[model samples]
Target: MALLQIISAMAMAIAAPLFLGQPLFTLPVAAQAQWSRVHEIPGFGLGTWRSNGDQAAHAVEYALSLGYDHIDAAHIYRNEDETGKGIADANVDRRYIWVTSKLWNTDHQPDRVEPAIRQSLSDLGLDYLDLYLMHWPVAFVPGDGTELDRETSIVDTWRAMEDLVRANLTRFIGISNFSRRNLNVILDICDICPYAHEFELHPYLQQNDFVNFHKEVGIKVIAYSPLGNTNPIYNGRHGNLPPLLEDPFWKKLADVKGASVAQTVLAWGMRRGTVVIPKSVHENHIYQNMFSLEINFNVLEMYNISQQDKRARMNNPSESWGVELFADLDDHTSLDGNKGQEL
Candidate 1:
């Protein structure tokens, strides 16, 4: 780093923590911008999956003031208003922020797409979103049932999303929970090809072939739920099973690097060429996650993590949603996607 840039970065790093009540760190330009505009993104983002109301707003404020330029949210989360307040609370210009919100499945109807963006913009208190994504590949029939709307094709939804961009409701558009086949379908029919694809990706459930396909198609990969769940131990939501967070490999590596497990996991996510958004409401976790970029890994270390991929997915919605969205996950063959591919 140049003497002036190094000194400037140091000043900002020190000041960020002091003002935000959390430690903030910076990575080199090349490392910071794995994709997208260099210096415009922080690579690590805050995922407000279940965060809500004023508390969720506070998290966003802290995250923004702590030097996180990216914030990933969704319409279904029903907290865009709070997320927006947090952005406002941070006291930063919108141009410096990259706010992403997803379109809910119910709003995938051609007529509802524009309204979804409009409502999100109002809820976020923004005139334009940095990026808007289709939350799922399938459209729901809406109600207490998991009935899939057989008629609303993703192609129709993509066209409406394209309209959103043209109308200046969002700066860019993308898709989430999309398989390789889903991407191919969009590529074949899109006038505005998707800019990114968000998915469940971690060491245990690494979708190598899927990610590679995204790279080949020149679309960015955004990883959600980067940290595999350890609910059995913490929340008693399931049986007492081993959690990936407690894996010996990651723990040992983290110890060697003098970092937390979450930090190392995030660093590995970046190494794989995907920007990771791990959600946390606690102060220490937020700091550690942002600072994870400081933990440097060599080629061998990265390869070792890559080799640990068991193709074990953590977020399978097939049962709850009553749709076979990603059966590749169940069979540990995401490389091939679902048989006859579920929409």
Candidate 2:
């Protein structure tokens, strides 16, 4: 039955590859081109950090329908097969979509980098990744939860990644969850600049300094958790700040635009020119997020929403190995300190 299903799917793809290329099996429409240009992203794309393949597939289908041309996955997500299935199900041109994946903290050592990326590629069922990132700056000796000695160095891991790019395992290489200190370390010794950087961001946690610094350095910024995540552990960090989607101001604006609060939040990211990947399992939410590309806020409305910053951050190093490294993190040059400041 599975083989039969696969054959049928392939038949569909061959029959109408361009016009009906989506996991949702929706017909192509004139609106597709507009959606593509409005929603297309160059760096980070679909993120499946906490979902299984079934859920990831649905999200990918929704993304393709909404005109997304990129998909981001990682070994830590444990859903690369599902992500791959979604790509196959979409029936889209493989060359048209940018696929990104990352090596986990446990695989950051120079020796583990190649094997880790090979395993990721195998799980993703892809020949090569469009971009590959070192999931974190710190390295962990396999099976241990602690970082290696300070002298171990990400520079060695980066060297391996540069070789992977040269060997065509991936086309681009970058980092995530890296602080300015860590980034500077890599920049000082590495030969190639990172094509992108991924970090948690939201209206309250604007991350303006890091964003500006990376832009100045020619590194694209990819915003994760743009919704001020409602995860309990994350909420605990901010003393359980109110959800941004439930705010009265956002609700009013949603009503005015006839869109969901989530959609409005995504539109803010799009308008700001940041590549955002807001995760959701619900079919409706996925479609809603994809359609957010069509929603536009007025200039005054954008400014007013930007003023809503309260310095509320959802992700922090409170429980991570580097918690101590960020203990005195009050400079506020990043999102946690600078609230209500203009970009």
Candidate 3:
């Protein structure tokens, strides 16, 4: 997989100039500025995936106090109520904070969509979400059993999500964990295309081509697990690969930049115009990550980081989900169609 990524990266490095030449190195200031104005999402935000109860609330409150205006939450995270309390406790003006949540797979059915968003609204104590997303491409029945819900087409679910925009349940709608093939499934036939697309992205799994596609279509890219391999949810199949933070190459770069490894990586994502949502319950880590926005990589630094791509995807459930989720990308996993719990 690493060899494949290296070859692919070399190919892209040679051919990239033919498409967008100048911005490839310099951060594309003009393009990024335009995206910022249009997207309105904070380039840096807090991710609340595993944090729950008081912990989740405290993290949200503290992050808000520390100048973070975006909070990523999901119904499946099972901490929306607590997360809302944290937001309320912070006393930050509601208009300033960007609260995002996702609809669970069970709610993919068109009829169940509105009810699900309403429930999330009730749980989060928010009248409307700044951004709402279809949690995943695959769907499941309301109850037990992991059978893929083939009856509910993604186009139907997406149309229902578009209605949420008209109904004002959420200001924007998007998708997560969707491959290019899955996105095309909606993009081919939809009244409103996704405003954003969130997925696993870091130095190791830098899907340059995939990310570029989103850019061409004007879909904002939200990078979850931006720190790479730090999320326990992903048990990598790579024999003994170190966590992204501990990589010697990244550490050396961090030392040269006088920033922590986490900041170094997060800054790389931001420099590329991708919004980074890094999850952390620790105050020090949260503070450091927010400060990543201040760090900038030079053209050489950016190129060096880009060369570190191993194409190692750490988040995948294709085997467990009974369907191929990221068939177009490398996940180091096979689709066995076995039943498994939602991540």
Each model's RMSD to truth, in Å? Answer: 7.3, 8.8, 12.2
lDDT of every model, 2 decimals: 0.76, 0.69, 0.81
Residue 214, model 1, lDDT: 88
User: In model 2, which residue pairs have backbone atoms overlapping below 3 Å?
Assistant: 53-82
For 1-343, candidate 3 gives per-residue lDDT tens digits of 2222343345445655654533345333233233222248877789999997899999999988776778999999999999999998987555556789998988898999999999998998887787899999877888667767877877888999999988877888999998787888888987877889999899989998899999999999999999888777775545477888889999999999899999889989999999999998888888777667768878998888889898987877677666766777766455443432222
What TM-scores do the predictions have?
Answer: 0.84, 0.79, 0.85
Ranking by lDDT, best first? 3, 1, 2
Badly placed stretches (over 4 Å) of model 1 are: 1-41, 142-145, 231-241, 328-341
lDDT for model 3, on a 0 to 1 scale?
0.81
Ordered list by TM-score, greatest first = 3, 1, 2
What TM-score does candidate 2 get on C-alpha atoms? Answer: 0.79
Tens digit of per-residue lDDT, candidate 2, span 1-343: 2222343345446656555634575323223322332232353256676766588887777665454667878898888888887887776655556778988878877888999999988887777777799887767678757644454467888998998877667777898877787788788887766888887777767766667788788887788887775543465565655677788888899899898988788778767768887776666776557656668878899889878777665665434453333222222223333221111
**Best lDDT among the predictions, by candidate number:** 3
Better of 1 and 3 by TM-score: 3
Q: Candidate 1, residue 221: CA error in Å?
A: 0.4
Question: Which ranges of candidate 3 are over 4 A from the true structure?
Answer: 1-39, 336-343
Candidate 2: 10-residue stretch with minimal lDDT: 334-343
